[model samples]
Target chain A: MKTITNKKNILYSKKELGQIQLLLPVILVVTVFSLAPLLRGIYLGFTDYRLGDPISFNGIENYKQLFSDEYFWNSFKIGMVWTFVVTAIQVSLGLGLALLLNSKVRFTSFYTILILIPWATPPIIRGILWRQMYEPNTGAVNILLTNLGLISAPINWLSSFEFVIPAVIVAGVWGEISKAAIFLLAGLQTIPNDLYEASKIDGAGLWDQFRHITIPVLKPVLAAIISLTFMWNFNTFGIIWVLTQGGPGGLTRLPMLAAYEEGFKYGYIGYAAAIGNVMVIILSLMLFMYIRVQLRERTES
Target chain B: MKRNIYIVLILLVGTILFFLLTRKNNNHQNIPLRFVSLAWQEGTIATNKSIVNEWNAAHPDIQVEYIQGTWNSAHDYLITAFETGDVPDIFHYESSVIIDYAMRGYLTDLSPYISSEMKNDILDVAWATVTRPNGEVDGIPFLIESLVVLYNKSLFKKEGIIPPTIEYPWTWDDLQSAARKMTKDTNGDGVIDQYGAGLGLRNSANIIMNTSISFGGSFFKKEGNHFVVKVNDEEKKLLQTIVDMLYKDKSVSPASIGETGAGMIPGLFSGRYAMLVGIGSWGRQQLVENAPKEFQWGVMPPIKAKTQTYGASTQTLSIPKKSKRAKEAMMFIDFMLSSKNTARLALNDWMIPARISCLSMPEFKDKIGGWDITCSAVSTLSIGSWLGAPGYVEWKSRVANPVLQELFAGRMSIDDAARRIEHESNIVLSRYKKRGEVW
Candidate 1:
C-alpha cells in the first residue's frame, strides 16, 4: 500500500473555493472603494496636478519641495508631538479606568455604559463642544477656572500657541479614551483568575502580580491599541480643523490639516497628495517595526 | 435564519437597483439643475428659496433646485465639487473665489450668454471684479459690501465724541486717538471693561487686501507679466495699523482680533467693544435679531488715510464649465440678478446691489440702519488688485496672514514680521511663476 506523498495541495479544495466566494463581495468593495483611491492618490503624488488642470509627470519634485518646506517640517513636528501626547494620555488613563471598572465595585456595568457615551459622539461634534467650552468670555472652562480662582485672566485655549496643542490633545483624548478602555477591559477579562489566585497564595503584592501576570498576558492587546491610537492621532484632521483650522500662527497645524489646506484651499492637489504619501510611508514604517517587535517578543517567550 | 437574512439582503439590493434604473429611465428628458447658495441669514435663505421656487414654477422645462450652503466651508466645498464634476449648475460665491476658479479655467466664460441689458445694468467696477485679465466675464457680480466702522452711539455719547461723517471724515491719527480715549476701565477694575475698538481682523488677508488701498498699500503688483507680492512699506502700514491697535494702543481686544465680522456681534452687543471695525452688512442685517431693544449703533463715517478707498469683493454667480445646463444656468443667474430681484436680494442681505439701477431704489436711500452710509460709500469700491492673481491666495494664507496674526497677537516684532513677509512672499510668488498663470 502506497500513501499519497503530496507535500502541498495543488488546488483550492471545494470548501476553500466556497470560502473565497463568500469573501468575494468584501474583496470587491475593498478593491473598488479603498484600494482604487489609495493607488490613485499614490500615483497623483508623482504628478504636477492642480485643480481642474491637466496633470503631468513631475517625478519627485513634490517631495523635493516638501523637504525644503519649513512649514511642512513644522507641521510634521507638531503632528508627532500631538500624536505622542494624545496616545500616551489616552492609553494610561484608559488602562486606569479599565482597572477601576474591573475591580469589584458598585454600578460597574452602569459606569461602563456611561463611559461609552463619548465614544458614540462624532469628532466634529466633540471639537465644536470643546471650542464652545473654551470660549474666553462665556465658555464653561474659562468661567469655571475664573470662579475657582485658578488664574486672573482668561486663557485663549484654542488660539494661544502655548495652550492650543495641549487643549486639543485634551479634547482628542476625551473622545477616544473609551475605545482603548474597552479593549483593555476585554483583555483583562480573558486573563485567568487562577493566575491571580496563585499569585495571592504566593504572597505577591498587587504591583508584583500586575507586572508579572497582567503585563505578560495583555502585551498583544496593548500593542494593538497603542499602534491604532498612534495611527489615528497622527492622521486626525476634523477636531483640529473645527477647533483651530490650524490657526493662531499654525501652532496646531498637523500634517493632515496641512495636506487639506494645500489640496482644497490652495489647489495644490499633487503637493497635498505628496504630503499624504509621506505620512503613509512614515506610519507604515512605524507599523512594520511594531509587528517585527511583536514577532520577536513572541519568539523570545 | 442566515439564509433568510441573505434573501432579504438580495431583495434590498434588487429594490435599490430597480429604483436607480427607473429613476434613470424616466428622468432623462427633464434633468433638473442645482443652484448652491451660501445664504445663511434667515431672511436671505428664505428669499433665496422663494426665488428658486418662483423660477422652478415659471420654467417647467428647465427646473432648478436650491441647495443651501454655508460660508464657513464654501471655498473648500466648491473646490471638491468642481473637481468631481458634481457641482451645482449655478453657484453663489465671491468674486475672489470666482477669479481663482476662472484662472483655473473651471468656469464658463458667460460673455456670450450674458444679455446686453444685463451687461449695461451692472456697474463697470463690479463687472471688472470677475472679468479675467483677457476680459472674459466668468461670473455675474451681484452684491458688494460697504466697509464701515460701527460705533456704540451710547458709548460715543458718554465719551462726548462727535460722530464723523462722510463729508468730515476722520484722519487716520484721529481715529487712533479716538479709539484710545474711548477705552475705559469701568467698575474700578484694573482690566479694561470696555475695549475702544474690536476689529474682526480674522481672514487677515481678506481684511488687509481689501482695505490696504485705503492705507496706500496695493500689496500686489504686476512686474513685466507675473504678479509680484510687494510688501516693502505700503503693505506693512496696514498690518502695522492692525498690530498697533492691538499692541501699541492696546484698545482692540485680543480675542476680537481673530473673530469674523459676524462673530464680532456678541462683543459689540455686550459692550466688550465700544467700536467694531467691520463691513456694513454686519450692522444692517446680522443685528436684526442679536441687537438689544433700541440698541443705538451708528456707522462712524469713513476714515481717510492715503486714499479713502477699499476693494469690493462682490458676491457673484457663476456657471461651472462642466455643467450640462450652462445656458439654463445663465438664465437662472440673470433671473437672480435682475433689477427687482437684485434689489430684494440686496435688501434682504443688507448689502449693496452690484446693478447700477438697483442703487437708485427708494429703499437703498433710506436713512434707517445706516443704509444712507452704506449707499454713499459705494464710490470707494476699487477693483481689488489681488483678484486675478492665483498666487495671492497661497501667499496670503502661507506668508502674509500668519505674520499679521502673530503681530496682532503681540508674539512677533514688527521688524521681524516685515522681514518674514517680504522674504516668504517673494518665495511664494516666485514659485507660482512656474504655473504660467500670470504670464
Candidate 2:
C-alpha cells in the first residue's frame, strides 16, 4: 500500500521518476558538451585572453573597445542584412514547396527526397561548388548569362563589391531552403484532411482554406524555423568564408567571420568572445519576445 | 554454460598473448622523437621521408618518428600542440610565420646547439631571418627564396628584346617598357589578346614588401631604439610602378593582380602572357614541368630599382621548448642540413640552399630552368625589416594586401591606399606595444 501510495503521489511518482532517470544521461551530455562551452565562452568575454598569453580579468574593457570598433559594427550591419534576407526567403519559399508536397500528389515521396539533396550536402562543399560556379572565366553562371545575352563581358561575382552580397545570398538560400521545407512538410502532414474538408463545406475556397486552416496549423513550425534560422544564419562562417572570404572588400564579412579572424588569425581570443557574447544577448532577447508572442497567440486561438 | 567457458578460455589466452607481444617488443630502449615535416610536393615528400629513414637506420638508440604535416594546416596544428603541451620534438616552418610562436616562448633557443663551422657555412642573410631582435636564435634556416622574373624565351626573341642576364638584369624602367613593347592584339580584337606581363600579385603583400627593399621602402623604421610602423612615398614606389603597368601602360592584366603565381602558369604556356614578374624561384621548377616541350622559358635575375635585392624569406627547422630530447632532435636537424644532404633537398625542392658550400653543387650550374640565374641572384638576398616584428602578419594581410590589390585594380587612389595603410597599420601595431602590461 505504501509503494502504491508512493507511485500515486501527485508531486512525485515512481513512473515519473523513472522517466526523469532516462533523461539524466541526455541532460548530462548537454550540460557537459553544450552548456559548459557556452558558459565558458561567456566567462572568457570578461577576461583579456590571447592565445598563448596569460589571461586576466579585464571587466568590460573588450566591450568598451567593441563599441568603437568600426570593423565590428560593419560586420554586425552586414550580418543583419544577411540573416534577415536569407531567413525571409528560406521561410516563404519553403512554405510554398511544403504545401505542394503535402497534397495528395503522385511521386510526392520521390520529390521529398529530392528536396533534401541540398540540405544533405555539407555547407563547406556547397560553398566550394558555388564558388566554382561564380568563377569569372569559365564558370557556368558566366556561360549561362552570356548565352542569355544579359551582359557582354564576364563579371567576377565573388570579387566584385556590387554583386557579392546578392550572389552569396542566393547560395545561402539554395543550401538552406531544403531544411526549412522538410520541417514545414512535417508540420503540414499533421494538419488533418478533415480540417480542409470542413472548411470547404463552409463555402471556403483554396486561399480561404489555407488562410483559415493551414496557416494556423503551420504557425508553430514557422516560428521555430524563423528564430532558429535567423540565429544560424547570423552565426554562419564556413560557407561564406569559403565563398568570398568576406571580400572584394569586407562587404560580406559577417560578425562570425570577424570574430573568427580576431580569435584565430589575430589571436585575440578574449575580444572574439566578447563579440560572441554581445551577439548572444541580442539574439536571446529577440527569441524571448518571439516565444512570448507565440504563446499569447496560441492561448488566444 | 559450456559455450561461455570456451569464450572465457579464448579471452584469457588473448590477454596473455597481448602482454607477451608487448613485452617482447619493448626490448630496445630507444628514445623516441617526433619530427613534424611540412613537405607536401611529391619530390620533397620522398626526399624528406628518405632522410628520416636514413637517420633512423644510422642511429638505432635515438628513434626519430616522421609525422607528415601539410602547409595549410600547420599553423593551427602547431598552436594547438603548443597550448596543450604536446609539442613535437622538431618541426619545419618558415621563419616569419614562427616569429609569434618564438616570441611566446614556445621555441627552444638553438644558440648552444650551433657549431662554429655550421654557423659560418650558412649565409648571414639566412641566419638573420631566424634571429630575433634580442639575439635569440630560435630556428635554423636551411633554404632561401628570392623574387625572379620568369619570361618566355620565344616571345623575347620574337619581340627582338634582349633577355636580361644575371650580370645585367632588367631595371624597373626596363621591365615596364619591355611589358609595353611585348603587349599586342594579335587577333585584331579591341581587347588585348596577349598581356605582356603578369605580376602574380595575389600574395602582393609579401612580394611587394620584399621587393620594396630595392626601392629602400622599409615599412618599419627605428625611433629612439624602438621600431615603429612607418609608410611613406618610398614604400609606395614599387606598388605605384605595378599600378602604372596595370592601368597606365595596360601591359599587365588586372586578372594577374587577382591570380596567384601557379594560376599564371596556364597563361604563360598558352602564349597569353609573355612575362611573369615578381614570382618565387620555385615557379621556374613548376614552369619546367608544365610548359610544352617546344615552349622555352628563362628566369631573369632579380629586377632592380635603386639596388638589386629581394627579401630573404627562408625556411627553418626548430625544436619545441618543452622537448625532453632537444639535443638529439638538434642532432637530426644538423645531420639533415649537411652540405651534401642539403644540396639534395634543395635540388629536389628547387630552392636555394642557405649553406654557402651547397651553392657549388654541379646541379645549380645547369642552364635548364634558369638554375644559373637563380643561384647567381643569391648575393642580392637581404634581411627584411619586417622580420620578427609584432603584428606584422596582421598588417600584411589586412593593410598591405588589400591596398595593393585595390591599387592594382584601379579602384582606390594611391594616396587613399597609402593613408589607410599607414593609419590602420599603426593601430595594429599599437596593440602589441608595451602598455601597462603585456596584452
Candidate 3:
C-alpha cells in the first residue's frame, strides 16, 4: 500500500503533464536533428567509418594518422596564417573607414550605400569576379596598371605561388571589409555627442581623441567583431575553392578545404571526422578566449 | 490551460496520423524510374529529354523521370544520393567514376542482360571501357569523344604552311617547327600578338597520356600485384618537347598561366592561339557559336611521337545496384542506345556515336566540319582507355593535376614533378590494394 502511494505521488498532476507535453515536440526535434548528428560525428572520429562500409572502433587511429599527415599539418598552418592576415587587415580597414565616414563628409549617405555594395554581394560571385579581375593579360587591373605605366609586364596573380595567397587575401578583404565597416559604423553612431565635445574642449587632437575616447568606448564591440571575424575566416572554403582550389602547389589550402576534400571528394569519412573534431576544439578555444576578454573588460569596468 | 494543452496534443497526433494514412502508395504494376543526366550540351540535353518524354508517352506502365544535373555538382550529388539510398534508377556519369562505383558494389552488372547482337553493334573499345575485369558490363557507353588538334586555317594560310592531315599527322618535331613558324608579333609590337598553340595546364594529364602512348611508353603499367610508374626515355622526351615549346620557343599560348583550360576558348576564337591541341569533338559547337564569322578552323588527328594512337573520353549511362526497377531501367537503356536513337543524339550533338551501326547512319554521313576526322580518329585508334585505373580520380585530381600545374608554373622541375606524382599516386593506389580491388 505504501509503495502504491509512492507511485501515485511520483505521477505528474494534470497541469504539470500538460506543460511536459507542450515541450516534448521541441525536445524531440533537437534530439533527432542536432544532438544525434553531433554525437555521431564524435563517435565516428574514434572509428573507421568509410562510406558504405561497416563502421568499426579503431580507437585513436584516425587522429594518429592525422598527426603524421603532412598535408593535414600544412593545411592547418596555412589556415591559421590566412585567418589571421585576412582578419587583421579587414578590421583595420573597417575601423579606418568607420572613422572617415563618421566625420562631417560630403555625400555621407551615398558613401554608406556604396560601402554596403560589396557586403551585399554574395561571396561566391565575388570570388569569381575577383578571379577574372586578377587575370594576367586581359584583366582590367592589368590594363589599368599598364596604361598607368606601373609595370612592364602583366603579373601572374592567380597562378603564381607567391602571389596566389595575397591575391586571395585581397579579394577576401574586399568582400569582407564592407560588413566589418558597417558593424563598426553602427557602434560609432552610438557614441554620445557630449563626450566628443568634452574631448575637444580639453584640446585633444584627432589621434589623441581616438586613442583615449573612441578606443575605450568601442572595445566591447571591437572584441565581438574580431572574434566573429576569426571564426568566419578560419572556416573560409567556398571562395578559395572557386578561385584557386588550393592549387599552384597547394599554397592556399586551408583546413576546411582539406576536410571537404577528405570527406566528400576522397570519401575518408573517419579521417574527415577527426579533422572536423579538431576544428571544433580550435573554435571552442577561440570562444573561450572571447569570453575571457569579455570577462576582463567587465571586471575592468 | 490543461484542456487547451490536451486539445493541441490531440490535434498534432491526429494530423500526423492522417498524413500517414493518406500518403499515396505507388502500385507494384506500374514502375517509375528516375534518370539523371548531365547538362553537357544544350542540344544533347534537349534531345535526351525529348527521347525520355517519347518513351514515357509510349510506355504507360513503365515511366522514367528526367532530372538534369550540372557538370560541377553531379559527382557530389550522386555520392550523396547513394549514401542516402535515394539514387536514381539510371544515371549518366563519366567513365572514370564508373570503375570506382563498380568496385564499391554500387553498380549492377549488365553482362547477362546485354544481348550478343547489341555487343556486336557497339565499338570494341567503347564496350571494353564499361566492362569490369571480371567480365561484367556495368554501364552502357552513351557518347564517345576523342581529343584532336584544331588549327586556324587562315593563320596557316597566312604563314604559307600546310597544316597536318589525317593521312600524315604532324610528328612532334614537325608540329614544333610549324608552331614556331606560325608564332609572330604583328605590328612589330614587343609582346606576342599570335601564339602557335595553347595547351591546358589542368588537362595536362590527358595530353601527357596521349603523347606517351604515341611514343610507345605506358606510364602506368600493371605489374605483379601493383602498378609500376615507368617514365621511359620516350615519355621524358615528350615532356621535354612541351617544356621547350612553352619556355624556350614561347610559341605556345600563356593562357594556361592566365585562364583555365575551359576559359581559353575565347582566346582561341580571338586569334590569340593559332593551334589548340587536345581539343575534343564536343568543342565544335562551342567553336561554331563563339568563333568569329570568318574564322576558318580544321581538325586533324593528334600529333604523333612514334605511333598513331588516341585516348577517348567516353561518358556512359549506368544502373545502380539498389534500384528496384532494374528490368524497366534496362528497357529504357536499350531504347536510348538503339541505332536510330543513337544516331539522332549524335547528329543533334557533336558527339561521336559509340554504336557501330550508328557510325554508318545517314545522319552521321553529312559533312560537319570536324566530325569526319574525329570519328575516324576515335574508331581507328587502338589506345586503351586513359585514366581508368582503380583510383584514377584521386590520381588525376590530386596528383597529376597539381604536379603538372606546379611544373607549368615553373615551381617544380620535370623530374621532381614526375617523381612526386608516382609517389603520391602509389600512395593513393595503396588504398585500393588494401581493399583487394582490381585495377
Write candidate 3's Cα lDDT for B1-439 as tens digits. 6677667767867877887665433334464788998846778888999999999999988888899988788878887877777778899887768877877778889888887777899898887777766688889886786777777888889889898777878898898988988788886868787889887665477667755777787677777766656666777787788888989999888665534555666777788888887766667777887788888988876777877776665778899888777778999999987888888787666778888898776656555567767777764555453344667776777777777777777777778877887788777778767767674
- Candidate 2: where is the Cα deviation over 4 Å? A1-12, A146-154, A195-213, A293-301, B1-31, B435-439
Every candidate's fraction of true contacts kept comes to 0.57, 0.17, 0.55
What lDDT would each prediction earn against the true structure? 0.83, 0.84, 0.80
Where does candidate 3 chain B have its weakest 10-residue lDDT segment? B22-31
Question: Which candidate achieves the best TM-score against the true structure?
Answer: 1
> Tens digit of lDDT per residue, candidate 1, span B203-233?
6667777778888888787777777766767
lDDT score, candidate 2: 0.84
Q: Would you estimate the TM-scores of all the predictions?
A: 0.94, 0.91, 0.90
RMSD of 2: 4.9
Off by over 4 Å in 1: A1-10, B1-29
Superposed Cα deviation of residue B76, candidate 1 (Å): 3.3
lDDT of 2 by residue, B249-366 (tens): 9999666856677777778878887998888787876776778889989989888899997787888899988776789889999988888888888887888898989888778878
Across residues A1-301, which tens digit of lDDT does each residue of candidate 2 receive?
Answer: 9988876676677677666665665675688689999999999999999877889999999999999988789889999999999999999999989989988899999998998998899999999999999987788999999999896767878766568899999999999998889999999999989998888888999999988889888899899988888889989998999998777557788999999888877778999999999999988998899899998999998
Fraction of true interface contacts that also occur in model 2: 0.17
TM-score preference between candidates 1 and 2, better one:
1
